[model samples]
Target: MRVSLILLFVSFRSISGFSQEAEEKKWSSDFSLELEVENQYFSNKGAYANQLQNFLSGAIKPKYNLQSADGKHLFKVELFFRSSLNDPNRTHFDVREAYYRYNKKSWSVSVGFKKVFWGVTESNHLVDVINQADQVESFDGEEKLGQPMVQFNYPTKIGDFEFYYLPAARRRQFPSDKGRYRFPVAIAREDIPFVNDLKEWHPSFAVRWSKSFGNVDTGLSHFYGVSRDPLYLGFNPATGLDLSYPVINQSGLNLQYTKDAWQFKLESIYRTTERQSFVAAVAGFEYTFGNIRSSGVDLGVVSEYLYDSRGLLTFSGLDDDVFIGARIALNDVKSTELLMGGIVDRTKGTQLYRMEGSRRLGEAWKVAVMANLLNEVSPKEILSNFRTDNLIQLRVSRFF
Candidate 1:
C-alpha cells in the first residue's frame, strides 16, 4: 500500500511537470482550513458509553485547490484528521475529498473522492450527510466516504442531472462499542489455496438525478455494490465467526422546498440484503424571520423520525425503532442560543429533553452548558428506566 501511494505521487508529479512545461501558462490555487471541538454525553451508559464516562474530540481540516494557469482546469483536494481527547481507539485520519475537474461551457466531470449526500432534510438521522450524519458527533465529527469514483453533470432547462460511477472502493466503517469490525477479516493460512492465491477487490456504483421547480428540488438515487469485506450482520460468538453479509443494494428519493424564509424537506431510503431489509424516512421544516432585527433573533425548529426493520440499531440502540424531536434557537438575546428538545419512544413513552444554553465567546469560539434529562415527567420507572445527565462543552471553531 505504501509503495503504491509513493508511486502514485511520483507519477502525478511527473505529469504535472510535463504539463507545466508544455502549457503556455501555469495554474493558480487557493487554500482554506477549519477546526472544531466537541464534548458529549450519553443517556444509556451501558449502551452509548462503553469506554469512559463521557466523550470529547477535536479535528483540523484543510482544503486545497489547483487551477490551470489559463484558468481552464481545476483540481481540488481535502483532508480531515480527528483525534480523541481520551478514548484509545478513536483516533483516525481520512481523505474527505480529492477530485479534479475541467470546466467547459455546459458540462463538467469530477473524478476521485467527493462528498455526496442524498437528502435535504434537517433531521438527517435517516439520510446520509457526510459531515453531520451522527448526532452524538454534532460538535466534532463527520460521516465521510472516500472512493475512486467519477461523476458527470449536464444542465437542462429544469436543473442539472448527474450520473456517477464508482468502479472500485473501500468504504470506511465505524464500529460500535458492542462489536464493530473496522476492517475485513484476513484469509487464514489454512483456508489459503495451495498455490497461494488470494483475491481482494470490491466494486460499488451509484446513479442520481435531481431537478428544481421554482423553490422545490427533488431527486432520486440508486446504489449497488459488492464488497469482499464482511458486513455487520449480527453478533454471534458461539460459532467463532463474526456474521458475514453480502454487499449493499439500496435506493432513495429526496424532496425539498425553500422559499421566503420557509423550508421543508423529506427523504426516504430502502436498503436490502440477504440477511435483512429496512426502510427509513425523515421529514423536517424550519421557518426564519425575514424581517428580524438580529441574525440571532430568528426562529428555528427541526424534527426527525426514523424506523428500521433490519433489527440492527446503529450507534447502539440509540438508533432505535423511532425518534421524534425539535430544536429552537434564540440568537443575540442575552448573547445566548437556547436549544431545548425531546425525543420519545413509541412503545414505552419514555422521553428526554435538553436543558442547554450556548453563547458565542467571540467570532470563532462558543461555549455551551447542557443537561439531558430523562423522563422529566413523573414516571413509574424513573430510576431504572429513566435517568438524567449533565453535559458541558466549550467549543472553539476557526475558519481560514
Candidate 2:
C-alpha cells in the first residue's frame, strides 16, 4: 500500500509539471469528471455466509490529460473513488490509469500504471491477463486494477509488436465481510498467499504481435508471470484456508473477422503451471440486421461455445457451455441498446440468464439496468454457489 501511494504521488507530481509546461507552450490540455450512483437488490434472502443485502453505491472519476505541442509526448491520469453504504470493499479508491507516453513514427513507449485489454469474445475475456480483476467491483470481471509497468510497441510491415515489463503484481480484491457476491468462506486479505518468494515485487513479462489481413484482425500473445486467478486451497496450518496465486506461463490467441453484417470472433489460451496445465477457448459469431425494415433499428444474434480441457474441474465455470444472446439497438437520438443472454451448461443442465439495457437520459445523464438469474444450477457446477445470488442492478451516471 505504501509503495502504491508513493508511485501515485510521483505520478501526480509528474502530471502537474507536464501540465504546467504544456500550458506555457500552449499545448493541448483537457480535464473531465463524472459521477455515478447505483442501486442493487438481491432476490433471495441472505444465508449465514451472506453479508449485505440491498446496497447503494456512488462513484466519482476524474481525469486529466496533457499533450506536447508536437504530439510526441502525452501524460494522462485518471482517479476513481467509490463509496457504498454496506460493502466496505466497494467503498474504496483506485488509480485506474496514470501514464506517460512517447510516440514516434513507428514506435511508442509508456511508463506508469495502466490497463490493457486483449480479447475478442464478449462472454469471457480469456486473453486479458495483464491487469488484476477488481472482483469486488463487478462479477463479470469487467473492472480491472491498473498494473504498474513499462511497455514498448513497434509497428512493422508484418505486424505490430508490443512488450511489457511489469515490476509488481496487484492481488485480486475480494468483497468485505459485509459485501455481496462473496464466497461461502470469506477470503480475508491477510490470508491471500503468493507462490513466488519475491511476492508482489516479482517481475512479470508479456509480449504480443497483432496484425490485420483484409477483414480479419488477429493477435498472438505470450505471458510468463503469476496467475491472476487464485486457487482456493482449503485449511492452512497457520492461516486457516488460504487462496494462492500461482506462477504461470500462458500463450493466447485472439482473432476477429468482420464481413458485411456478420462478425466472427475467437479467443484461446494455453497455460502451464508447476503442478498443472490446461487449455481453454471461446469461439462465437454475431449477425446483425441493420436498419431493419427501414425502422432505423438494428438487431443482432450471438452464439458462442466455451471449452476447457479441465472439464468439470475447471474454476472458470465456462467449460463445455453454450452461450446465446440477442442485442437490440434503437439507433435513435438517445442511443438506446439492450442485450439479453444466457449460458447453458450442457453437462449439468444448469443455465444462467442475463439482461442489460442502457439509454441516455439527456446530454449528460445515462441510465442502465442489468439483471442476472441462475436456474437449475447443479451442486457439481461452480455457479451453484451463486444460485442464491440472482440480482438486479440499476445505475445512473452524470458527465460533466
Give the top-scoring candidate (lDDT): 2
Candidate with best TM-score: 2
Stretch of 10 with least lDDT, candidate 2: 232-241
Report how far residue 221 has shifted in candidate 1, in Å.
Answer: 0.9
Q: What is the C-alpha lDDT of each candidate?
A: 0.54, 0.86
Give residue 177's lDDT in candidate 2 (0 to 100): 64
lDDT of 2 by residue, 1-400 (tens): 5666777798778867766676578778789999999999988875545476798999999998888888898888888889998887778788888888999988999998799999889888899999988787888789998888899999999999999999988887777766656666666655577788999888899999999999999999999988888764334577644557788999999999999999999999999988778899999999999999999999999999999887765766788999999999999999999999999999889998999999999799999999988899998776666777788999999998
Clashing pairs in 1: 26-69, 27-68, 27-69, 296-331
Global local distance difference test of model 2 = 0.86
* Candidate 2 wrong stretches, greater than 4 Å: 232-242
lDDT tens per residue, model 1, 65-89: 7777665677677777777765434
| Global fold similarity of model 2 (TM-score) | 0.95
Q: Tell me which residue pairs clash in candidate 2.
A: 236-240
